[model samples]
Target: MSQPPITPVTTPPPDKGGDDMATLAKGGRTNTLGFILRLLGGLPFLFVGFRLYGVDEMGRFAAAFVVIEIFALICALGEKRGLAQRLTEGIETDEDTPANLVFDAMLVSLVVSGLACLLLITFPAIIFPNGTGSDFDMWMIAAIPAFALTEILLAAQAYRYDIATTVRARAVVEPWVKSIGITAFFFIPALAGGGIALAFLAAIYAALLTALYSFLRTYGLPKAWRPRPRYLSKMTSRALPLIGADVIERGTRLLDVFLLGQFTSAGTVGIYWFAKEVVSLPQKLKTSFEPILAPVITKNLKTGNMDAIASQVRQVGFWIIALQAGIALTLAIPGEAVMGLGGPEIVGGTGALAILLAAEVIASMAVVSESVLVYIARKRNLAISVGVITLQGTLSVGFILLVQHWGYPEGFQAAGAAAALFVALGVASLVKSLVLKTLLKAPVSNWRWPLVWAAAPAVIVGFIFTEFTPEWVEIIIGGPAIFAAYFWVIWKYGFDEADKVLFRKNVAPIDSDLNASN
Candidate 1:
């Protein structure tokens, strides 16, 4: 059966931008739902993990997993960034897009994955190393095909506005499945413990199988899947910068974790990972919006609709900052309670979580620029990324050296790492926003409300909560109230009539905004 032609939504008439902001805020809400799903998926794994393996053991499990993941990220370099562009023009022009892009994408994916596999094979000591255990090494080998296949197949899903499926498959089902299976394995005969790696390999393959089927069902099978030699060469040329961009982006995120494993104990990596996860949930929660935002911004750029482009750029940024600031305030204010959630040994991660969240607070702006620039000014965008990541690498390595020389506390090192990340991201955000202003002629100033209204209120509320509220009670109850009150103030007072309309898009725009007049 043939599907209806894909239609791009008409741009809302830009004004004060209340309704438009609301619509995209709603997109953040959807991302929040995806986050909840991810949390639900992760909790089962977390609970089972703690019960079965405990914190220190779980940390060791994470060591091999991080390397395998970094390898996977390296393999994904080009294909991920380039997909949004390939379909941008076609989606907007209402063209009969060819299915062959999938094949071309897959071919590129295969070559990269093969290269990664060869590297892993040739440098087993370098890749898996001697200390992380033979079980982990074996799991990495088993996981290579599954990780590569699942990630490679995900681009087509992004092209189709089918984010919910990707969300369900990865964030929802996969983790949940891993949790349940691993929890059961704790009772397995003779295998006394340490099945976490095996559980992950199983869950990943399950996700891979499901994702591949979903892609095939949505788009027809690979008739045009194979790229012609000439066509392949041309597409590869366009993708080169993106390969560099993705390497810098994903590589930097994983680089620290990999290095921490090498220099520090698996236990330190565990504490660091715990803290990073707390604040990162919100960042990861918002990630679902990236796929949708990418195509929309790319299409707007292709059509030269400056209004649509600016509106989206502003709206997504506004929404992301509002949400992340809320999460960051929660983590930073009562930093102890969040870290304590993992157990007493992990309490040291609190400072790390606070710093990482602060860094993510800055990074939210850069992520908005990441999607917008990829379509509107990919070359300029890529250059900014190169600069930022270069800055990050130098700062990270140098800071770690400085800290090692000083012999600081475990948590102090995390704080320094987070501090380094904050500085790097803040600089990067400024550069990218400036680039967007110069090239795309988009107003970076439109993102100011989030910086001022949202960030200010949350910071104030966090301060008040810390000072006035009692310790254990505040974390248990008052902590949540602080978060709630801050958002209420901003969403009610900070947001104007334009903001109100987004929630009430189902009703008349005026009706939605006026509801706020109360």
Candidate 2:
């Protein structure tokens, strides 16, 4: 079929200062809500998996889940970010409608997911090299389209700044459905073993259906549903850089598992996976900003407003670092107890959990920096990711081998892998930050001394409680007390004007007086 005429996208006019801040604040609120829902809905599944099925079954499920997620990312073709960029450019220039963008992304995702399903069906061994069983293998293949479509729909809604749709489908509906389904299936003798995996598959389809209904309600149906081959070609080409960056990024998360599978048992992989998943919660706070930041950055880029772009980056970067630092301290201080919740067998991953959490904190700068660079210097960003992941892979394998050869305990083997991850990520973050600084000719000063000050007290309190008290008291009481102190310190001393703005409040008058006196 003939392609529609391409509309040339133009630069959008610069937004006023207050307007920009207001946009960010709104995005932050919605993203935070989504984060909370995800935590509430998702945590139960983790507990259920570990509590009911135990480590080995959960490990097999994790392996299958990882493979399915990787394929979904591939089929998404980077539209999670690309769609936002495209829509921002198109909307600003009035060259395309929301319907068309959604339609195009949906079409591309369907095609790519179909092909991925075929590939998995053709070579089941690729996903389940260790044999995930026939039922799980089938469930994994069946879930591909649903997983891929949910990604596209969420991206589409994010383009409209309707993050609540994602929160509803992903955080609320999907996880809850899976959790309930798994719990229900536990009583059935025949379905008990692979029930969690099946529940997960059912949940994906449910979420996809919810997303579709939400999309239609919010944006209505596509006006002209034309399947233009050239449109698909253009989108694929545009998304290739993003695809590479995403694959490399996700590879960092899964590389540990893949390598561990070779060296360690399924139970070990399950332990590592749980630790990684827990540490990743804070990372989500950073990602939540992307859907909002993309449109703002793209708009500024169109206007050739490098100053605005840098300011946004610095502000958002600092916000993320400050929050993440506090979260890392909170989680890592009671790491052992937190892991213990997953059962006695998984508590051995405490060291790995602490190391991984630290890695996320160190890597926050690079994560925010890459958000900007991906739009400005796509190829360079991709190259940096490739280099980082290659380094990570090498170190991970070497560390595993070294630990095994040195006769370290099996538990420490995971710690060694995690340490390798921390080192690679820390170095990569430093390099990426420096490169971004050079490009922007602006310093990314997200770190403040007060963040350290705030974290110190929280960590001290958390450590005391975790060490001296029972696990329940440590997690329930200590966590809240530590976080309370952290937030109070941050409020009294660490918060800047931008942070105050998020709360719709100005700096306190006493602080202003203190500043004036100084």
Candidate 3:
């Protein structure tokens, strides 16, 4: 149960003071590999979920999935982000601190999760007024703590510089379990709807065991490990801010699922969710970096190195914009082909998918801004989150009105939600940029070149590909071209001579303590 944070090295261990360009290239390659593996591994589970559960049941499962995640975030209370920063910043590498802290965090989480599960199990009818799930659903919700712990532990591993464990558990093992379980649901009638829930419990535990083993092997058990009150206090103090931020951020996403559950049926929830999944596929590319980016950015900030942080922030933004844009473009342009594959049952979802994908494209900037805010000014990060949630709620209400005024159609309301979210994302991105710039006293204006250059090329790729190949190939090919264009534009125009010099200098160093932070 003792997990410690470690540093991540990009490629073949750097030689003495390895070159900065080599490290960045290696880091890019590392992220690229993780992205590929996640996409390949996640697809089978997603496909099987679609095929086995059809649309309505899949929607029910998806809604619960989001709800359980919210509960998991509550259990975490932000230790994942907080610990990643603390350990890597080389504040006080007692090593013993993090190892024991994991158990303490797990203990607190166990209590919170247990109490929540008890209420859910015993009072299912009492809590969920606009009931979509039964007592059976409540039981499924019990797995929340273990799953959340698995997530935190994975983050711990990444900070420990053991990223492959995280990738394997999330990308490979979790998906493999889910895909096989979903496939099994097709044959075992007993395993049909609720079975998806049980499968999640099994998968989480399996992943937990895998992570526990990996963490132990990579970083020995917490030194002189024993439950202690003072240790818990220290860890909790560090994580408190993180806890608040995590709650609001995740709560915002969960609010969407919960709101849908209230006014709509599982069937409608399914429709909205199907549209979300289709439109949000671009998110997968960024998801792999979720564990890695925070620590990397935090390391840069520890040295009071604003330039490196700004460079990374802009570079990541460019990549996210290019990739997310192509995905959103493909989904929006050929909405029918995408959801029609879900079969006629979910075909009413095409319009919703188009609107949601549009939202996702705009949301890319907010996605990258989040990392910057987290690393640079954590308290301000909380403020940014509040701003995001406030905007999201405001947009949600107006969008609902739009749907009502537009004359209700099957997917019209969801389309309204997507439109609202898109506007909210734009506001959040601008706010995030300003906050980051102010925090670092750096010119984030540098992020524009990659975006400006990628646009024309992206448009050209979309039009020509739509005319020539199928939507799938368009998805396959369009993303990389846009990304390539963005990278070239950035390397050429985004970086100044001084920027390249800094990039050139940061390779391997004999300074172990500094390298540990890196």
For TM-score, the strongest prediction is 2
The number of clashing residue pairs in model 1 is 4
TM-score of each: 0.85, 0.92, 0.81
Misplaced by over 4 Å in model 3 are 1-28, 88-98, 122-136, 279-281, 449-518
Q: Give the alpha-carbon lDDT of every model.
A: 0.65, 0.77, 0.62
RMSD in order of candidates: 5.0, 5.2, 5.5
- Return the top candidate by lDDT: 2
What 10-residue stretch in candidate 2 is worst by lDDT?
A: 509-518
What order do you get sorting by TM-score, best first? 2, 1, 3
Estimate candidate 3's alpha-carbon lDDT, on a 0 to 1 scale. 0.62
What C-alpha lDDT does candidate 2 achieve relative to the native structure?
0.77
Compose the digit string of candidate 3's lDDT tens values, residues 1-518.
65456433222232221132334434444555665665565556566666666666666776777767777787875766766765543325645456665666677777778887776667654334345432344556767887778877877776755567876676667766766665675577655555666666667777778887776665556657676678677767777667777777566655665666655556666777777655534755544455666666665665666665665566555555555665565456546656766667677877778766666666666666676676556788888778788878777767766676777875776666666667776777787887777776765532454555645655676567668877566556754554555455556765544334333334432332113324
| lDDT head-to-head 2 vs 3, winner | 2
Q: Candidate 2 — which pairs collide?
A: none
* Model 2 spans > 4 angstroms off: 1-14, 91-96, 505-518
lDDT of 1 by residue, 187-264 (tens): 875444547776787788888887877776666554524457887778778777777666666555656666666666
Model 1: ten consecutive residues of lowest lDDT: 509-518
